[model samples]
Each structure stands twice: as C-alpha cells, then as structure tokens.
Target: MKLKELIFIATGLLVLTSCIRKEAPNQEADILRCILPAEILADKSIDYSLPFDTELKAYPIYIEVKGETNLSNLAPQFELSTGATIQPASGSYQDFTSPVYYTVTSESGTEHRPYAIIIRYKQTEQIPTDYHFEHVELYDNYYIFYEETDNDGRFTWASGNPGYALTGKASSPYDFPTTISPDGYIGHCAKLTTLLTGSLGEKVGKPIAAGNLFMGKFELLNALGDALSATKFGVPFYHRPTQLTGYFKYQSGPQFYEDGKYTSNKKDTFSIYALFYEKTNEMPFMDGHLPANHFESPNMVALAQLDKAQTIETEVWTYFEIPFDYTRYNLPVDTDKQQNGEYYLSIVFASSKDGDEFRGAPGSTLMIDEVKLIYE
Candidate 1:
C-alpha cells in the first residue's frame, strides 16, 4: 500500500459520502512527523549510519516513509548515486571508491533530503583481543571509540549522540558522555558521563539522559517517539562468554530529581550489567523495553549483572567480576561454530541506574578501565 495511493482511495470514499453539513474537516495532514530515511537497509546484518557509508563488495538499499504521506499521490523517488548503476534501475549502485551522494524525494513532493554515501571496504577480525578504548576520534568535542584500522572504521560502540543533539545545547557532545580520561588506570580509558537535559528536553519530560555506551546502533525515530524504545541494545557476537571483569569508580551527585520533582533523601545508584541473548529470525536485538520486557523476551540466553550497592568514593579504581550465568535467564547452551553472529552480547554501565526512566542527578560520574572479557 503506497502512501499516496492509499490517500486517494480514502479521499474518494470520503467525497462519495457527500456530507451535507459544515465544510469537511480540513483535509490537511500533519507534517511534523516527516523525517529522513525512516528505514534504510540492504539486509538485516548491515548496520546503517545515515549520512552513512559502507565498504561491502555488493550493496543495496531500501527506504520507507512516515507522516503526510497520505497527502500526495506521487511515489517516493530517489536520485541515484552518480556514476554507478543500481539494481532496480530506478535505485542506485556505486563503485564508492570515492565518495558518493544521493537524495530521496517524499511522496508529497514538498520535501527532500540528500544523503552522503561513502564506500570503502576494510576487513577486520571478527572480535578484537581487547577493547582498551585507547584509540579514539573527536567529533563535536566528544570522543568516539575507534580502536583499530579497518576500511569500515572499527568503532563497535554506540551512544546517545543523536538524541542529545535535540536538546539545542552547544555542549551536546557531553550529553553522550563519551570522553577520553587521561587518568585511566592504564594509558587511556573510556569515560561515560550522564548529562542534564537542556531547556528543550525538559519541555518533553525527558529531563535527563544517562551516559551509555552499548554495542548497537541508536534509532532516531524511536528516540523521538519514546526514549525507551530508542535504546536498541546488543550487537551480534558469536562466541560464548565466560566472565566479564572491569575496574570502575563512581561518585554520586548531590541532588536527585524525577518526573519534575525534587527529592532529598533519594540517591541514584549505578548499573553495570551484561546481556547475552540469541538472535533468531524472530528476535534481533533488545531495546529500551529491556527493563520492563526482558523477562518476557524469549531470546534471553544469559544475563550477568554487577551488584554494587553504593557509590565507591575511593580515589583508586576498584575491581569487579561478574561470571556469566546462562541458566539463570535461559536454557543451557552448546558451542556451535555456525552460531557466529547469531547471538548478541552487550555490557552497559550507567552512573544513574534509574536513568532510563529520565531520573537521575547531575555530576554523577563512573570511570572504567582495563575491562576484560574472558571466554571459555
């Protein structure tokens, strides 16, 4: 059902009704919901980075629509990448040895956006020996993980960079709370910080955002509609994990706020946990629903959670280890080589454990270093 075609059918039926009363309700549709690349992908496996680039040998793309689509009969159209051929002929394919550009036109024909495409391939070992967070790149003054050299850019981590941008804050980079701390226990380490939402966020009930570094892409559409749904967690990992160990230090901020109210007695706690799960054809990744829906998800294979009760005010880094308890969440597992990329694992550490619900204090900090993932 193309959007405009559906709209015509709907409008024709409405006209036939021939309401004799007051002027028909204004036919105008809402436009605020229009956004870029509602969904763009070649396959379920390839990750998308809008204004995205790829290095795959063969690639195809798909795009969908949202909002005001019912207002026009025109089909969504594409400006195929220059100089390259595409599969459907109307679409695109590019050599991408150099950068490429493309555009998509809305069905309504009133709006359009250009997308930059880059195609350069670099291969990498499925998993790195260690993710020291030693190598980093700066974007908007915030640091993003770039651990190794590969054609694809070896940043396996994802943060709330895009959501924070909505706050209209010049310091939005800090909102992602991804920074390089020189005081790392080792040479350099990853630092994740939570930030207070700016004026724009408070208007929407999202008063604050947790500092999160997870293993998958963040969906912008979900971020706008529901914050929880936006936190898509986990990336495909083939190997079975035995243990997760890391060093961390956390300090609590002075005040606590929740749902537009202040509380003096309540103190925010931190959360550090790992989720190991299966990726069947049905279930792909966990999202913001994890807190409320985790137990019901059939894909849960194992879960390991850090159980620190209070903030450790110590100046020195503290060591903690959480052994994987697969049976606690799901049935026993077997080692299968074919299972590669069929399972997903994610480790998350937060300064405010309740930050997911938009509750937390400012200045709360958590520092981690020398993390190790031991597999059996």
Candidate 2:
C-alpha cells in the first residue's frame, strides 16, 4: 500500500473511535409504576396500586381491608425504566408484612438503585386538636413532624421537603424548606421557609419551593412533571370543625420572585387555611390546584381561611382565629356520610401564598405554633 493511503486509513479509524466514546450509556434504574393484583386484596373493588416516589425511591402501598389481611407470598407487578431489571423479579411472591427491599440494575449494567416497598393498612382515624408543634423526627437527614394520637396512633404531617430533596440543594434537615425551629411560642415549632431550588428546579419549571405543612400525602410521582397535582390534600374526618385558631410569626424575603425572575412590585405573603369537603368517587381528594370559584365548589362544605390582611409580614407572634363559613354551601351536611368517614378535612400552612404557581420569594419564613381546631 502507498504511504499516503495507509495514513488516511489510520485517520478514519481514529474518528470512528471518538464517535463511539461520545455516545454515553444510560444509567437510569427506576420504578415507573407498581400494581398489586386484585386477588391479594381483601376488597376487590379497591385499587391497590402504589404511587412511586422518584426522589426517595420508595413505594408506599396502602390497602383497605375489613380485618387482618395477608401480605405474605403475594406477587406485585412493577414497571421499570427501559431495559432495567429488578431483583426478586416482578410478579414474584415475597413477604410484604415488613418492608421489602428491591435492587434494580440499569440496562448498561453500570449503575444500580435500591427501592423500598412498604405495605400499610389503611384506616380512618380522627385527628387531634391543639397542636403545640412539638413532636419531630429525622429521616434521611430531613425533619419530619408527627403527632401522637390519644389512642397511641402516630399521624405524620406531610410537607414539601421530599419534593425539595429532588433539587439536591439541601445539605441537612435545617436546610430543607420545611423544618423545625427552636424559637417557638412555647417549645419547638414548625418552621416553613421559601427557598430557591437551584438549577435543577429551574430546568423543571419549578424555580422555588415554599415551605408547607398539610394533613394529607405528598404524591411525588408527578412532582417533576406536574407539581400542582402532586399535592394530595385532606384526610378523613368524622367531626365538624367550626373554627381554626393558630399562632404564627412571619417575615417576607427581601425580593419577591415570580417565574424565576425578581418582581419588584410584588410583595410576598403567607397562607393559612382549612378546607372541609365531601369525599366522593368523582373527587376523592383536593390538590394544590384549587377550584376557580374557591369556596363555591359543590364539594366544599366549608372553608376557614386567614384573610389576606392578616397574612402580612409580622415579626411578633400573632394569634389569629377564622370561622368556617358553611352558609355558602347549598347542601346540608350529611350526618350519615360524616359518620361513615366520607368527609375530608385539611388544614394547610405555607410560607408563600402563591407558592403552588412556582412564584415566591426565597428566605420568606413562617413559624406556626399552638394550632387548634374548634369542633361543633
């Protein structure tokens, strides 16, 4: 072969190698969805599918049973990322009375992810009044507030901390949007602060995270894709609430930000409200996307919301009381449904009033303590 021809062949081979190196391998090993077969469920009519938390890599399945239900030797199906495989195999029977751990291997076999499958029995329990903002625990380096019921039952408060964890900005429990503060009206209180979610949050169109505490669960499955729908609000309540009273201290951040930009004219505000609504098959629960008519929704039995004027920035601890207005509701309260645990009530608090729209000022803080719900 000619010397020039040999050199040309070598150059072509070098270009081909460079192209191969540029193509990176996929490293995603995640569970997209989980479904439990109807045969394993005590109530065949109930859906036993679990919501997947991408950030936490866990599936918390709640099953409704009349009495004790068998959780052992039950196969659960899982839908995983493309080309990913789960150990113990999908649809393979395994004990689930206790949490079961599963490991997933990526298609490229270069990465692995561990997931926890937690099985919980669903039960309706009435919430206690007069929260002193006391009980809290640390989970995966983040603060989780919970309440101890009179019956020795534990009720955990849901917050935006788990969703904020997806940003990978928080370093400690205190760094999270929702956390505990030592400076309470009496003891430790629940502190909510709006914080910037950094580049990752901006990329997903959620530039800021507002500190919030609510009665229901935070569905992180669609958090990155649809944040508004991720917040499943309300829990079953048997009693009727008349008023909501609470003590709070608030301080708005220096600059208000909206849609990832600073808005000079806008001032930050806080939100404190409680909703009493009917739980029907059509509308099982409320979410961050509140109805346009607000209290006019047919499902809304009553609402106790702090007035906008009362949400102004205040350095001193302020006590506020709001009465639930049931007059706006056209239908009479169904005593049968209330006793059957068909009614739902949710009390929500947030650092920024418009946080659900991804508009808020970072550093805005709201500390809540001594919350009580007056019953009828």
Local distance difference test scores for all models: 0.62, 0.82
Please list the Cα RMSD from the true structure of every candidate, rounded to 1 decimal place: 11.4, 5.1
Q: After superposition, how far is residue 348 of candidate 1 from its true place, in Å?
A: 1.1
Q: Give one digit per residue, the lDDT tens place, for model 2 in 1-376.
A: 6999989999999987777455455688877767675544432323223445454566444445433657676677888888889997999998977778888888889888777776555565678877877988787668879888999977788888888988899999999999999999989899999999999999888999999999887877767877877777888888889999989999999899996699999889989999999988788878887632364666888889999888878898999999998887855789988876778989999998888778888999999999999997
The superposed Cα distance between candidate 1 and the true structure at residue 98, in angstroms, equals 8.9
> What tens digits encode model 1's per-residue C-alpha lDDT throughout 7-76?
9999999998977776533322111211233333212333343323233222223232222232122222
lDDT of 2 at 16: 78
Off by over 4 Å in 1: 1-88, 91-101, 106-112, 115-125, 149-153, 172-176, 294-296, 309-311, 334-340
Q: Which ten residues in a row have the lowest lDDT in candidate 2?
A: 42-51
Cα displacement (Å) at residue 193, model 1: 2.3
